[model samples]
Target: MLNEEKSTEAVSFDTEMSVEKAKDAKKTLKRLIKLLFNQKQKIIIVLFFAVVSLVFTMTAPLIFSKAINVIYEGIKNVSLSGVFNIKFDVIKELSLLLIAIYLLSSLSNFIQQHVMAAVAQTLVLNIRKDISEKLSRIPLKYYDTHKKGEILSKISNDLEKVSDTLQSGMMQFITAVLTIIGSVILMFSINWILTLIAFLTIILGVAATSIIGKKSIKYFTNRQESLGRFNGQIEEYFTGQMIIKTFNMEEEATKTVETSNSKLYSDEKKAQFITFAINPLIRLMNQIGYVLVAALGAIFVIQGRLSIGLIQAFFQYVDQASEPLTEAAYILNSLQAAIASLERVFEILDEEEETPDAANYKTISNPKGNISFEDVKFGYGKELILTGIDLEVKAGQKVAIVGPTGAGKTTLINLLMRFYELNGGKIKIDGIDITKLKRGHLRSLFGMVLQDSWLFDGSIKDNISYSREASTTSEAHQAAKLASADYFIRTLPHGYDTVINDENSSISQGQKQLLCIARAILANPCILILDEATSSVDTRTELEIQNAMDNLMRGRTSFIIAHRLSTIKNADKILVMDKGNIVEQGSHDELLAKNGLYSDIYNSQFARSITAKAL
Candidate 1:
């Protein structure tokens, strides 16, 4: 009972979100139709064949009625004889015509189906291409705000749904509508009273279906959202499985996933419950309509006003008319899922992209490694993280920034890369404001190797030479050698050609970081930034990497963010940051001489090491 109440509350909340999604669905559907319209020529041909098929199908009943009438005339004209026989010449001819029409209809159906399928596949291809382009253009903030699974759901799941709907549902809808309209008109030609009765039943069935559909569609939309959240959880949890196990959080993670799964299950059940009932309810209405048409036809025949053959034909028309109505209703109900999917996909497409650069942006031919920050202020939102910050770096200098976590060490790197726009002040390179230069051009002048090593699924050589497409194999080897990565890479079975799959679990984290260093080294940028580049490796590997980094940083202005005081002992200048401001700035020995914040931090780490050794 408690579960039931929780489900109700969840459903109610989901209903509101679903309603908003549904409102957008219509607009999204229109846009989808517009996309299909791009291949209007193929669609037009498909429509023509569909209509021709419907005409043959609709005319078959009239021909069948004619055959019945022909049989009646033949019986009436029969002469009394001991071996009396009746000729069915006219009936035979009509039967032959009906068979031919059915054969032609099948052929037309096949052609239309083939064309429509081709059109659907092409549309999906184009949409995927557009989505791929959209991903590259969307701002970094968009990625920060949205979960990876949600974006992927839009691309893969949502787009696939839209494609399925277009392939099958769209054509069914058009044909069903045409069948209904044509059946109604033909039924009227035979008997208006019976036609009216049939139409009333159709309207009642549609009304009931509409009521059910309205209730069900909300749940369907809710299910989509739940599924998205569930997928995101899976993606997050799977990627963080190591951390979860390390912390013994397996049970907690399972409970969290179960909660998400339960919500999805509830919504799916409610939605399916309502939607699945529509068909049976409509069938009930159709049965009632059949009874009325049959009973009424008998009375008309007995009154000598309606012929038996005509009544038979009218009965067939009633069946025909009601079927399309039922079909259209069901197709429309099913389209809700597709529409919900479309809404999500369109939401991504409609996200604001990164702003384009100024028409006449600055370009650097040969950037000197001179960087300065003048009164720079920044924050995630309202509270400034770095207020009234200033800094200056000369070419080919090694500058190390040491600070406690959340002291704006990484934020400075983010600002320098223009990953986020600053709230106040300016950062300049070679006396020119970085903001005046195009983002691509500005970023091209600097190279970064952060703590998190990003290596895509590719060969070792490919990963090493990612920054420079034109870099030769020799250049990649040289870069790897400089980063102390060449020997291990060469030891692999495929050497540089060994494929690094998505997980890259084949390579150690230290190796991955070394490859990243090699990549940055290959870029040959005027300025270099290393954010805890050696934090993940062992002492021995760190020494090797530190040596490689020293070589890489030569002839370039370098900024290093480090917590290990030993690593930065040789730094030309060490900036001791506290609470987002540089509290002290000088050479390492000078900072140690001050006996202030830097000394305290250095002593604390030394004490921790000695304490660990004693333990």
Candidate 2:
């Protein structure tokens, strides 16, 4: 008895959860509809067509009903010249009216479908643009956490589903409701008793739809989630294909993909099965309703309570009623799927964006790049990466930040660029608080070269001039020469016009870095940031790059983050960072004499280069 009670309790808990979920689903559906219809001005054209289609659909059964009554009346009273005259020439007139009704219905349906298609396309285009704009405003951390494939799924698959709902499902749903309403009124006019029976069948169908629809919605949500995961896994695997081969982990990679694929397939199948069941079940119930209506109508006619014409019209009304219920079942399933997609899209759009502070400050006309960080504290989250990093760099002074891996050197650069806000203290440039300056104007003053050199799929010339506007060919060539990239660039078959594919092409990593340097040089910013700029180059290439860097840093205040100590040995000041704190700061000679963290790192790096040369 206790076990039975426990089971009952568990079932009751599940029931309550299911009810809550259903309520949430309804809310989500309503929200999605509101979003779709909010662009009322743009959607009015499509709505007009939808309304016309619905009216025509509703009138189709009525036309047939009227024709049946007219024909019955004509047959009841035959016309034979002087012998007899038909009360009304109902057959001839009804035939002509039926033809006109069908023609009008066809024309309206054609126009409605065309308008709906146009509306769906337009809405999809606008939605994609809106998503893209929203993504641009979102913080970088959001992209860092999300997978590329998952984002793509939202823009592609989810948007496609929304389009499907708009183009077909929405129209079907409207027409179905109108048809149901029309059929019900006509049925009541024919026989109230049969109308009551029809109502019971409809209610039963609705109940079944509700039960199956809940399961369908749950499964569809799961299916979309699984698809996103599957896409993410596939993207990750392909991105790391080289690593998998080097590690001899092909089988492991395959297994991982297989597992993800299996989960996706299972979820999809389950959702499809549940959604598919709705229409068939509704159709079965509809067929039963049809049979009951026909039998009862025949009985009424035989009892002399109903005319033959009235029975025929009643049968037509039953079929019309059943059609809408059948369509409603299908449309409800489709609508549930669309809601799943819309929810995912909205999830991204609703994410918090980076908020810039409300402060307008004087624009730096000729920024001298005098940077100061006073007791700065920052971190990714709870773990503090930078603590009390007090530092200053005079105008045009070359500052080098040297640190062990994960010692918050890059975090400092990120803070300077305002990519992440500092938890404590202030960063100022030219005696003005950076937080008060517009990010766009502030970033425009800095030329940054990251450890990983990124090149878009475009011509070399295009890559070199990827700033605000296209650079002149002569200007691009000059920048390339300053970066020591012009020599190899000219040797290529297409030279500056040679197209490079995404992170691919026969070019070496050193060449890619040089190209990136050229890009930064073309921008001609007052402040330059070189982060492991020559880390991938050989000794000869490094010397060439060092010369290029010397030319680039001639008139600019530069911040160099280098693992190679020799490159920054001549810096005006060297700051040694350890666990988010500036433990030591001095010139190269001064730091060497102090024999601290900076000295140790410099010696280790210099000795390694010497040993490599000896070997």
Candidate 3:
């Protein structure tokens, strides 16, 4: 029973912190590259443009150096009193060429940015599309195990991180690498001694950043996972506020959320501090490299080992070499986080999907209301929930299943609908093995009204019509009328079109139950399973709905799992189940005569009703 004895798995901080950094990060990065490489043409174009921009940028410094030497040479040769013999035409031409080079570099940069932006959006779109399809393929059992908000965070938070990295982080990383490479080559060509001095300090900064980056991966992984854990608590508690209020446990819920929030804050703070801490240190080292190059170049100029023009060009190269690292500190940080998020999304995509339907699967056009469970044995895991269950219901029989909590009543229904596959048994519908039939068609034969009423963010008409896509508005209204929900629906604003969601308080729990019943009525299946379907409705409304359900179940094979034994007195047969086995089976009168478990339970309920009325 979904309502009782719920033992749920909580999101634990210790579990989130245990993410395997070395193994998973490397694997995730490899997969991400493979996914990105699928857009081979787009990547190639972006790379080509980025390289072109780097080439143009590198050439500008050299031209400026040549112009500077020309001016310096003219100054040295001329007397103080005479006109300076600077090669004005040559300097002017070099200046113009440098300007053109800068313009071209900017243009290439713009083209790459534009193209990469498109590629980024396309990559995430394809990933999100695949995720959407994968969601439909996963089995219902997966949902039972995972938290709602954790799963939602994968779609919202994790994907957004990936999208952001792809959009800007990727482009920045590419450009930064190219800038470093081009600048180093130009610096070496100008003066190897100055280049060596500048590169030593840069290498130090790079080494430090590398060490820090490796250490931050674990924290980044934990922070993202903790974010998912926090989201799970918020979603669970927010959605279950009514239960908290009913049990007067508001303070408890708040404390639980506060614990989760504190963990998130701690993780986030550590992640951010470590990620951004590399920036200032990198800048300091690069600044030292700049000053060392400047001091060394001045000595070389005095010794006539290098010209003023060459020293100026070497300074430009050093700045360009260090610039990428200075900016890339945060890009590297974001890239690490994005890679972690990518791993989470991939984990979901790689989860085992539901069993596939056989080729040319059979279908039942008009199923007779006969269901037989033959020596059925099943379990969620290794331990069996339903053991050696054998039962047969003839066509048009109204069967009531009476059981204590965890007695496998709902499990039996789940098997009949094939929501979970059996471990060692076969179930047949109308003498045909259910496994041979198409799963969708097999499930379509049964209509279900569970205790927990499910309504999405849609209109009353939409919710009712969900069972049958082709059902018309009039058909929906007719079904609603039969479920005894038509009158209250008409009283609402916008009537059948009023939207339903968690925020809406106008629709009562009884109304939600009525809507679910209306949906089942619209399905109009040959087999009906009502697991405490009328439990939420008031006594008077339940009576009216019961009368309506009896008419609807006239010829349909129905199974009712009810808590109020008075409601099932007229059932065609009553099966008393205990601890996953049927203890006794008979009509209501026969069971009462035997004075078995069913009788004792019925008497207890009767006593409760009498006592309540007397009070």
Candidate 4:
């Protein structure tokens, strides 16, 4: 008994140490408990049925033992047919009672499992929905720093792990604990000495489990991280498969995948080996305990200090008591894996979301295209991308921004769209500070077309009409015609009805850009931001796109970020930037006559084109 107490204390200490080392595991467990607590009513119902089922299950062995005792006594004191018939009648009654109890126990178990499954699924659904909503609210910086594949793995794989654990592990854990307590009580009632003996031996098994479980936890955590890395690599490789093939780096990509896979295998193997080791050691201890109990019970029976029924009951109770301990090995492993997954999920949930609007925020119901950046300053982290800027544009004017790569060209557009908050200064539209306006309302005033054209799996009409909630076929056709995409689109088998599952698979890059431009044309915002809008097309296609853009920019304030100086030669004003500052701003002719940075860039491009034509 003293050994058993000390052993329990050791296990407790080990558990505390493991938890201390794994702060994330502890936090995740607490969060999961909080989530479960929200389903109190369902949990209470499950517990009720589980307890009832456990009672019926535990009591059956006692009744069976009693029946055995009765049979033994009857056979030993056989007198005649009259005695035998009376004993038989009593045994028959006990058997019927046992059968009824077993049926009730099974029914209770069924109900408990049914209710738990429902609760688990509901919890999973809500979690997934919350994650989806969270993705929208989180800052764009989060996506920039994190991989899409890793985030997706947490949403799908991690949540599935949590769901599986909640469904089976919760009920199993509750039942195991109840069974251990019930079995212990019955064992003591039969014989306190044997009960003590059983406990002392089981404590050894528990101690082994605690030690092994502690060592395996780190490996389990590593396995989950490796899985995330592996998934991320797969996503990157698949998305950039064309680049890899072009560079002939297929072997290198395979090597990268294999490295991640090998790491996962190593961690998984360690965790599983340690977990599987516990069961056999426990089984060995259990067999040893059975031998001790039988030998002691037999001696006690010879001295008439123990009854045959109790000896039989003790045998059954010994098995029942140790069963939970053996199953604990498996349960602990599953829970560790689930907790690891939960930590990843909670990490995302705990991230700082995008800044929300203040109380009494302004709304932009009818916005004019006038925009101003007053001494604006911004950065990624601590390094400033745009040091300082002051710019103003009137409605219906075309402004061009040109700079070398990484001169904060894209960063300017990002700030305008409110994808990233400015570190300092203010951006205003029509004399109202945009910082005071609701982001959704502010964004609705502008339309954008980028170099990379994005279209999801949908029909051509659906993709073109995506900007409007309801657009007629004729409206879509007009938008496509304006962008010069109608000719090729109509050449397809189904015309506007043709589905575009893979944008690059069927359509050329230029055609994809045309479709994007048509979508933007359909949106028809008061302001337009075009980033390398015609860079993907050939010269002929570029001319068509420029003509279409000219029509689209008729009365809209437009900001064009372009590398090809020829494309923006007719802009109302061109802002030449270098090192995050606008070096010069003027008409193309004025800048050219000035012979400044813009002139140099334009002259170089002209020289290159002339040289190519001569060749």
Candidate 5:
């Protein structure tokens, strides 16, 4: 249960960090959008279309009103000549003008929308590429603390929201504002009294939307976060499906998913309710404004203060004015969602990158691999794993490191590879500080084989030649034979052409180890580190592997970490470590003579193995 608490705590901490990083992503998106507008001619063209469309839409009502007034004047037998002079024939001409205006307005709208989408999509594509490149350059520690699902969600889900905002939201926002301003001006020109009534209703509608929008912001943010957690859980379940089934924890896993699903459903329903409420509330206010405008316009016509044509124009203008207000409300909702996604993506982009300051450093070309650690101190966080550790290995010498569990043997190798920096003292290779060499060049100098061998999904030939430098198929085959892997590989159905899925391959642990060794041998590094390389093999296989190890270690500086004492009996030097300190060091025979920690460990481990075999 304590372990469960620790795991939950770890999950919570990571989630919070990711959420904070997402918030920073918004700034990155905003900067990208700003850069798009740097092209002044393109921006001007889009704005010009928007303005023209709004102007043409506002003129439609006046044209219809004039046509009605012309008919009324002819029916009343009033002096239609020079009395508010608008020719009956001219009214027909004006109707045609109104049709032309609406047609132009529709064309302009289509062009502007297309331009906006093109600009937005281009910006989003650039952002996606930048994020992918940045993620590749980051250190492995970042991945250790992050989930694959959450990272995938940012690229797929969050990035899609940003795209939506660009393609539609931004252009709609601008168009809505322009539509409202143009319609309002025309409304006032028709009837000041009616315009006030329409304006008051719009203000009330906006106030309502603003209040509800604020509450919806919190819900939207929660919804996005819940989705990220849900994705992470799904990824974990699928990756560990075999373990869960073996343990018969299917019900427990289902419950975990249900809990997350329930939270997401509730949050989504709440957010949808609020967002849906916006359109209806605005429509209701527009209906009220419509009634008020018609009532006020009727009173003005009866009082002889306004023409019937003018009253008709006021009614039409009121409806047009309401459109922009409702559209503004919709834009606000979309902006909220876009902002939520942007914040998440920015979090990853903002993380501090691994130090890349090995620029003033020199390369270790053909490094002789004389390694020395002088008073080295290291730790993970606060727990010191290695203290005052001092050791040396000459070129072409094989040194073995043996220790009880938790004695920092692996940590020492990690320092040598520069996976983690030392907290104190210095390490040197061939009389040069390892820290003073480029990280890539320093790492290229060593070949490593660990107990757990990882193979990417590829052909056997491809896996053997994973290094950047090119090697022929013949060379790969030669290396595989040296590692004793060629015997089984040649017997496989496809031999070198067989494609291996990342999962569902049936290679034994020993075979996998040999493959890893073959991969390392193909690199031909001057230094070699073998960490429990033969721990997984059977007696017969171990003998074959030992011979391969001997060939690989020839004329190369080697560091062998092993628990099997017999394997290191022929080593030039054996260092016995315990509790972050080297308790004893000498040739294997000399250590046996001392009969201290090294001898006791060897006697106990090897004696038990021999006795078990006798039984």
Candidate 6:
């Protein structure tokens, strides 16, 4: 994907840019809510606990007020020169009730938190599953056009944001709304004046939160975008570390990272500053409301218009209500950020998947490997890479394609493998149009060994048997021995069980090529594809690999993309491609006799080899 970079920009721009509009906020929110509703059982449990918790919490203040009133009345009577007596039983009962209320409140709160935790984790788990499944269905062009870092960022970073919101922020939002409602009712029951004063804070908080939230949407969106760009640079730069170091471009690479990093910092700062500004401003308004309520409460108590106990209860209500009011701003910001994240995640989900495999599709097993390309025309983008190409191959025929870079050598193999659909014309295998065949069935007919030699982090045995898992261990061992990989495997730490990865230097380039050849050998497909399979190895190793490839290709139709003309000298047929069309076709010697492009490339390579041998 980094190889597709064409612009002189500091780093490649994400194709997803400009799609994260504030307008999608509504749709994202609705979709998220719909996802939550899907977990109705858990949500119901959470809601039940929340109600119970709120009930217990609201009861505590009333009980405390009663106890305070009892004590105050007793003190007043005693101060009036009466015998000092207190309702000790009532005080005891009230104390016990308050303790029970608080304990129950805590229990309910714990239950709700526990249930919501499950809801949040489960929701994220399912979304990840959807994301994973969606990735498999999308066309290869998406990967070729889009930056890998951005793809990874959406999967990891954006999901984390959504997860964080659902985990705590969601519950906080629900509880905040509930607590505000209950506290307001109780506040009004005590005194409308104090409730009104408290509401001044709410009004101010709402106005400030609404304004800040709208402004921060773009900031958060930009923050994620900037992070995505930075991630792209990191992914590309690190993956290309070998090239960078070989060319001594460390400074240039660092500059790329720094450029993207600086942009990320600038955007994140703005997003964070705006998101956090709401809390303090709202809290300050709350403090002012608190002062006004407290002063008025004191004056009312002195005038005997409101009891000390009731005013204290009113103050408690104010604190309870104001708490949510203060958090309203923060929660709004979290929701907005989460929505932004969801927007990006949904972009992946909403991508146009590869046209579905047709219903009642055909299957091919043990195909005769008769392949024909009829006026095949294709392109990655608007510009065609391959145009009006026609070819015919009989069963078990050996075909070699040769060309310089960008000459459509690899693209031909890609089209043959059905990695990309043809823009025009039809490709037929054994006289059946490939479009009618199931993709899995079509691909299973061929085995491929690329020059890069891909191997996942797994046992060597697994790597060899990757193409055909149904192959027996004995078969894998035989394949390894045939490809000349068995000797190397035995020399390793764990022999056949030795773990290897793409980056494992323990296996030399030639050895990795051998393992890949072994994999192709194990599959035993009706056709084979060799894409510069021996180009990276030394001449000695190249000879060994060529022998293994010869064995694999024997009696099987094969298409080989060769850079060294000498390697394909014995090829049954050679197809010379320039630009996108086949310019020449014949046996190696027959094509060289023409003294055209194929002859020129071969003579140049031959001259180079002769000179290197002389040196």
lDDT of each: 0.83, 0.79, 0.86, 0.84, 0.80, 0.86
lDDT of 6 by residue, 1-615 (tens): 012212222224444466354457888888988999999999999999998888888878888899899998888778455775578899999999999889999999899998998999999899999989999888766787689999999999999999988888888888888988999999989889888988878787888889889888888889888888788889988889999999999998898788878888998999899987877898888899999999999999999989999998888888888888767678889888888888899999999887778798887755899999999998776677778999999998999999877778887887887777789998999998988888788888988888787899999999998999888999999999888788878999889999999989888988998899899999999999888888777888788878877877889999998888889988889999988899999998899899999999988998998999999
Stretches > 4 Å off in candidate 3: 1-23, 77-82, 87-92, 246-248
Candidates sorted on lDDT, descending: 3, 6, 4, 1, 5, 2
Clash number by candidate, in order: 0, 1, 0, 0, 5, 0
lDDT per residue (tens digit) for residues 325-387 in model 2: 878887888888888888788778889877755465557888999999999987655656676
Q: Compose the digit string of candidate 4's lDDT tens values, residues 1-615.
A: 001011121122210112234446777888888988889899999999999998998899889988988888877886765565238887999999999999999999999999999888998898888888898888877776577777888898988988998899878878887888889898998899988889888889878877877667677777777777778889989999999999999999999899889987997798788778788999999889888988999999999988898898888888888998788767877888888888878878889988887668887777778899999998765667578899999999999999776666777878888888888989999888887988888888888888778888999999999887588989999999999999999999999999896535888888888998999899889999898999999999999889989988988999999999999998998999887788899999999999999988898999999999999
Best by TM-score: 6
Which residue pairs does candidate 1 place in steric collision? none
**Higher-TM-score candidate among 1 and 4?**
4
lDDT of 3 by residue, 1-615 (tens): 133321122211232434554447888889888888898898999999999998998888788888989988898899778878999999889988888888898999899998888888888899899999998888767777678788899888999999988888889888988898888888888789888888898889888877888888778788888899889888988888889999999999889889888988998999999877888898888888888888888999999998888889888888888879766777887888898888888878999987787687888877888889899998776677678999999989999999887777877887887777789989999988888888888988989899988889999899999899999999999999999999999999899999997356789999999999999999999999999999999999999899999999999999999888889988999999887899999999999999989889988999998999999
Which pairs of residues clash in candidate 3, taking residues 3 or more apart in a chain or in different chains?
none
Candidate 5 contains a number of clashing pairs equal to 5
Report how far off residue 473 is in candidate 4 (Å).
Answer: 2.7
TM-score of each: 0.92, 0.90, 0.94, 0.94, 0.85, 0.95
lDDT of 1 at 336: 83
lDDT of 3: 0.86
lDDT of 4 at 509: 83
Q: How displaced is residue 334 in candidate 2, in Å?
A: 1.9
- Between prediction 1 and prediction 5, the one with superior lDDT is 1
Task: Please give the range of 10 consecutive residues that has the lowest summed lDDT in model 3.
Answer: 6-15
Error of 5 at 62 (Å): 3.7
